[model samples]
Structures are given as structure tokens and as C-alpha cells.
Target: MAFSSPELNFHKNIGFLAFLPLKTKTSISLISGKVVALEILYRMVYNSLTAFGGQHHERIRYEQSLADAKKAGLRKGLYLGISQAFVNISLYGAVALIFWYGPYLARIECWNYDAGVVMIIFTSCLFATNSISMFIPYIVAFIDAAVAGAKVFAVIDRKSPIDYTNHTNNQPHVVRGDIELRNVTFNYPARKEKKPVNYLLFSFYIIHLESL
Candidate 1:
């Protein structure tokens, strides 16, 4: 199957996440959406500053994030699928029992104890089988998350990019505030796009992007 088929509706599970139709206490329709977007922006900035929590590159980290999100969604879908599968299997198994055992039980000489025993066994099996199935995904997910979290932590634990400068040898030469960076070019990842070389002129820096 082509897993990457047509796009899926984002609101299937999270449909009720927004009550656009229902009368909202707030005036704005996108109030909740806007808040969420802003939160994400701040979180990204925080991650960039404090930790390597975010993927780093010329926006390649963004693709890593998208991959993680996609993988997570796939795993969640798989877990739910597993749960549903177990439920259906249990139902079908019980029906088969009904067809094969129910009639036979009815004809039993002393049916009370035998019928009770059968039900208990079936119920026990139902819960046990489904419980194991459910637990498997959680255990796997936990392990996967732990590994991912470790990698993320490792990134954050890295040495600081800039160390403190010793001003001893560095006599503060009066800067004319004239900054000149020659032959500066930023080659952004993957794409053919070229980024403008960053320049900061203290007093007045005349920047002519010959690159553009």
C-alpha cells in the first residue's frame, strides 16, 4: 500500500479539540489556534537557547521534527489499530464459542457449574489476551521514546557554543564601527536557495549583497 496517499483529515481524532461551531466564550474563532501557534514558537526559541532539544541545521532540524511527528502519529495509529483488532478478535471468538459451546451447554445434565466455569475461562482469556496486546505497544513506545529522549538530552548536554572571552590581551581598540565581511555567502541546506549573508554594521555599515 502506498502509505503516503492522499492527505488525511487532521481533525479526525482531534475533531473536538476545537469547538468552532459551538458558542465559544471568547470572541475569536482562531483564538485557541493562535495561542497554540504562539506557544510552539516560544517553545522552539526556548529549545534553541537552553538545550539542543530542537534539531539543528539550516532548517533540516525542522524535517527531523516533522519525521518525529509523523512517526508518533503512525505509532499512535498502530496502537489504536491493535486495540481495535483485539476487541474484534475477542468478539468473534466469543461468537464462535456461542455457536459451538452454547448449544452444547444447554444440553448438559448439570449446567450451572459448567456454564459458570466456561464463562469465567472465556472472560479471563479475553482480558488476558487483550491486556498483553495492549501492554506490548506501550512497552515498545516507552522504549522508543526513551531512546529518542536520550538523543535529545545528549544534544542539549553538549558544550556551550561560545566561551567567555579574556579581555586582558584584547585592549578595547576604539572601533570606527565600520564592519566589513568579505565574500560572505550562506548556502542553505538541500535546496538551491541561497541565504543572505548576515551583516551588522556598528556605526554605519554599507552592505551590498553582491550575492543577490
Candidate 2:
């Protein structure tokens, strides 16, 4: 079957998307979206460092392709550093606020010191427990397996023009004899009207051998 250039390119890109740094991004997104809300921000900070290597590679490749490659690299690095700094500041700042305000509130309201401490500890533990749900290693593995299986099945399910495996009477059987080539026309599937040099030469040689 004939395929347009865009269709072929889309298929090629879709095939490679599964092999890209998707799992890492998914994990990081899960952690940041869920765990950050629970105040268990340290895990995300650690995970971010691990994920940065993949981003670094992507940034290097992308920046190097630009007209002002060095400037692009510098801009990317500065933006990343600033963003990471903000994240760190926000995480620690929230913790500091909790500790500082918790004591003040406890003293002013005549609440027990131990209760305030327990509240902070309990909140942290609650988020820590919830964060465990984000470690979906099995889910990622299953998704990868499913994608690979789909690709494999697509090829297997496709009907080839020439079925060598068919053993029925309707199928032609190969005999242990020399095959003859005559005035036959050959064209590639994509370009039916154009006779490529290699195909023309191959066809010519086959026809010449048959004549001899």
C-alpha cells in the first residue's frame, strides 16, 4: 500500500516515542503533582536530580542545533538553575513557615507543644504514605510491553502480497529448478512509474541469464 510522507514520518515518530525519556517524565510529574501537595517535597527534589541527566542530554542536542548554539546553551542552563532554585526555596520555605507559625499559634492559643509537634509530624507522614502510590514501576513496564506487543501484532496481522507459508493448492510451490525471466516490468511499491537504476539492472541481468 502507498503511504504519504507525513503518514510515514508520523508512524516512525510514534514508534520511537515509547523509547524516549517518557517514563522518567511521567514519574517526575506524578511525584510533583501528588507528593508536593502532601509536603513530602524532599523525595521530589531527589527524583528531580535523577531526571535532570535526561533533560541535560535533550538540552545539549537542541541547543547545539541553534544558530547561536553557545548562547542557547547558556540561556537554558540559567533558566533551569533558576527554576530549580525556586523549587528548593519554596519547599524549605513552607517547612520553615510551618515550624515557625505552629509554635506561635500553640503559645497564643495555649495549646500543648507536643500536639503542635505531632501535627507537623503526622502531616509529613500522611504525605509520605501517599507518595508510595506514585512509584508505579509496574504500570510503566506494562505500558511499554503493551506498546511493543501492539507493534509486533500489527506486523503479524498484516497480509503480505506473497504468502510463502501458504501450502494450499491455490499457492504456487517452489520447484528445485532454474527460474526464467522474460520481458517483465518491475516497479517499486512507492513509485510505480519510476524504474530505479538498481531494479532495472537487476531485471536486465535476470533476463540476460535466462536467454543464455
Note the Cα lDDT for every prediction shown. Answer: 0.45, 0.45
Model 1, span 1-212: residue lDDT tens: 01111111222223222221121222122343344455457876765533664434424544443453455455555555654554455545654665467447746745453666666755665555444434433443444455447547998899774544754554546755455555556643332244545443323354533341
Per-residue lDDT of 1-212 in model 2, one digit per residue for the tens?
01122333343344334432443333334433342333223533665634555555544433433324344335434543543444344445545656666667678766565565748664774454334323322334554566457657999999887776877637546554444445556654324446553322223332345432
Which of the numbered candidates is closest to the native, going by highest TM-score?
Answer: 1
- Model 1 stretches with alpha carbons more than 4 Å out: 1-68, 71-83, 90-99, 102-113, 149-212
Error of 2 at 198 (Å): 9.0
Residue 75, candidate 2: C-alpha displacement in angstroms: 3.7
Count of clashes in candidate 1: 0
TM-score for each of the candidates? 0.31, 0.29
The 10 consecutive residues of candidate 1 with the worst lDDT sum are 1-10
Positional deviation of residue 70's Cα in model 1 after best superposition, in angstroms = 3.4
